[model samples]
Target: MQTLSELGLAVAQRRRALGMTQIDVAKRAGVASDTLSRFELGKATDFGARKLLAVLAVLGMEMQYSLEGHAGSLESLAREHGLRR
Candidate 1:
């Protein structure tokens, strides 16, 4: 995602898809329930990497990275470069 709010929303979606509660995820991730609530609600401004990674781990998820202009998938890149029809 392009921003922290987007990331938080994604986490919330995943949690819901997995039928997980905020308290359960927070306990498993070693964070406060209010913290997770704020995060999922896009109200957290300083949720750190450790807590984020912990939550992702609890949800069987991980973060990915790409340089600014290198975020496209292979299919999109091929299309943009005229290598695909």
Candidate 2:
């Protein structure tokens, strides 16, 4: 998840899950197939922000943030019901 390839693969998987081709998404995002391919293939270390956002928009995805220690990283949310580690 920290690498380009991992992110690209995830995006590719989700796009495929939606039954869309690379061309379809690229066109929708107003980008070239090659650009999307690099993203899907995990070759691009820095996928352009605007273009990446566009692709995410096409796929109904977005970037969000969460605070660590405030909420559980995995199994539970810390401080919920006074839970403590």
Candidate 3:
């Protein structure tokens, strides 16, 4: 499982690889550049999921879910924790 910092790094690397600046991504994602900077820095305080998703969409990425090792299905985990998927 990648930590928030790792994920942030990956996003930053991908953006750089595509020759896109932070400002470009911010404009494309409809977010402020400072917010995007915080995300790239792995601040992880209160990043809105929808905002992150929008940013990722601009970077040609989408969120997906999967089990962690042999942790069983996500449905089972959600049921155990009273979470809805």
Q: Pick the lDDT winner.
A: 1
What is the clash tally of candidate 2? 0
Q: What is the lDDT for 47 in model 2? A: 82
Task: Look at candidate 2 and tell me the lDDT of residue 54.
Answer: 91
User: If scored against the real structure, what TM-score would every candidate get?
Assistant: 0.87, 0.74, 0.74
How do the residues 1-85 of candidate 1 rate in per-residue lDDT, one tens digit apiece?
A: 8788889999999999999999999999999999999998899989999999999999999998889769788998888888974
Inter-residue clash pairs, candidate 2: none
Clash pairs (backbone) in predicted model 1: none
Query: Given candidate 3, what's the lDDT at residue 85?
Result: 94
TM-score for predicted model 3 compared with the true structure = 0.74
Local lDDT at 6 for model 1:
89
How displaced is residue 21 in candidate 3, in Å? 0.5
The local distance difference test score of model 3 is 0.86
Per-residue C-alpha lDDT of model 2 across residues 17-81, encoded as one tens digit per residue: 99999999999999898989988987776688898889989999887655654644543654465
Q: Residue 47 error for model 1, in Å? A: 0.4
Of candidates 3 and 1, the better by TM-score: 1
